[model samples]
Target: MVLLLFDFFFHPFVPDVLSLWHQEFDFYTLLLSVVYGGIIEEIMMRWGMMTLLVWLFWKVAARKKQVPPYAVFWTAILVSSLVFAVGHYSVTALETEITTPVLVRMVILNGFGGVVFGWLYWKKNLETAMAAHICTHLTMQAVLVISTILS
Candidate 1:
């Protein structure tokens, strides 16, 4: 609930976010985003990368004969989230047509979203965090569709 509000309200003030949403506003686009963005994105970012990092960390801990606790779990979330943010920045860099202002807004929005996902992981668990992330993407797509219909 809080995260949804953050995504909605913060987007307008952040320039390109609302613009990006508007750009993606359409029935076909919304459907594609739900399938690709909502599911595939979360799978790659949270489940794929983050899960791999956690596994590697576990292997290291096992080699050292030390069992990591909750702190280690939280640290893993933070590290993975930072990596995700960096990846997002790289994507922005690759976009030749993206303006400086739009790039800045994208970085901020993606980074903020990553942070929220990390916090959710810490608060609940990986499953909950992934659900929240997916929800955000799905909700964004829905908002785009609804707004297009209204306007």
Candidate 2:
């Protein structure tokens, strides 16, 4: 909700990575984002990367356990989230000047969401994380469409 509100209200000041979707709102693109962004991102970031991190930590650091320790788990989440944030910045890097503020904002916002999704993946399931991510994109798209209509 906070991320949605930030994208809605302060878009002019701190544009989101998907701000282009607002300018050129296409149903197919929105659908693809909701579907693929939710599933694929979770698969890549959490299931793949975070899981790998945990496994590596378990194997290398905590040789006694099959599962990672709490510290290792949290560290994996942070690292995965940072990687996720970096991935989001790829599009922005092509057009905008990647400044300190932009980098900070990207890490803070996207990384926070990534961590939440990562936690969901850890606690519940990958499907839950994917559902949350899909809902987030849908909500953002809905707001963008409505704001466009109003304007």
Candidate 3:
């Protein structure tokens, strides 16, 4: 909910990453985003990257605790989110004619989503995070479709 609101409210009034979303808001694209962005991205960012970082940090930085410390977990979340943001920025740049504002927004928004997913993965299970990710994309697609219908 927070991430959705953030995207809806924070998107630039002028040209930005929303331009890419508006341009590519088709059934196929939506489906791809729901599946790839939700499933694959969660697997990579949360399951793979974040988990690895937590373990590594726990071992190295947190002095090999039996369980990961809070600091270790948070460090993992922040680093993985940064990575996720950079990955999105790189890929989005290739597809869109991104200005600085667009690129920055894309990085920040995706990074915020990454933090959400990472938190979910830590608190719940990977599946829970995956479901949230999928739902986010589906909800966005639904809004786009409804707006198109109304307009």
Candidate 1 wrong stretches, greater than 4 Å: 1-21, 58-67, 89-101, 118-127, 149-151
Report the lDDT tens digits of candidate 1 across residue range 24-80: 556675566556655666667677776676667777764464665555566676777
Clashing pairs in 1: none
Q: Residue 50 in model 1: shift from native, Å?
A: 1.8
Better of 2 and 3 by lDDT: 3
TM-score for each model: 0.61, 0.84, 0.87
The lDDT leader among the candidates is 3
Off by over 4 Å in 3: 13-17
Model 2 CA deviation exceeding 4 Å by range? 6-12, 15-24
Candidate 2's residue-wise lDDT over 72-126, tens digit each? 8888889999999889887667756777766676677788789999999988989
Best by TM-score: 3
What tens digits encode model 3's per-residue C-alpha lDDT throughout 33-60?
8889999999999999999898889889
CA RMSD, predictions in order:
4.2, 2.6, 2.1
- Give all candidates' CA lDDT scores: 0.63, 0.80, 0.81
TM-score of candidate 3 relative to the true fold: 0.87
RMSD, model 2, all Cα superposed?
A: 2.6
- Candidate order by TM-score, decreasing, is 3, 2, 1
What is the lDDT, from 0 to 100, of the residue 44 in candidate 1?
74
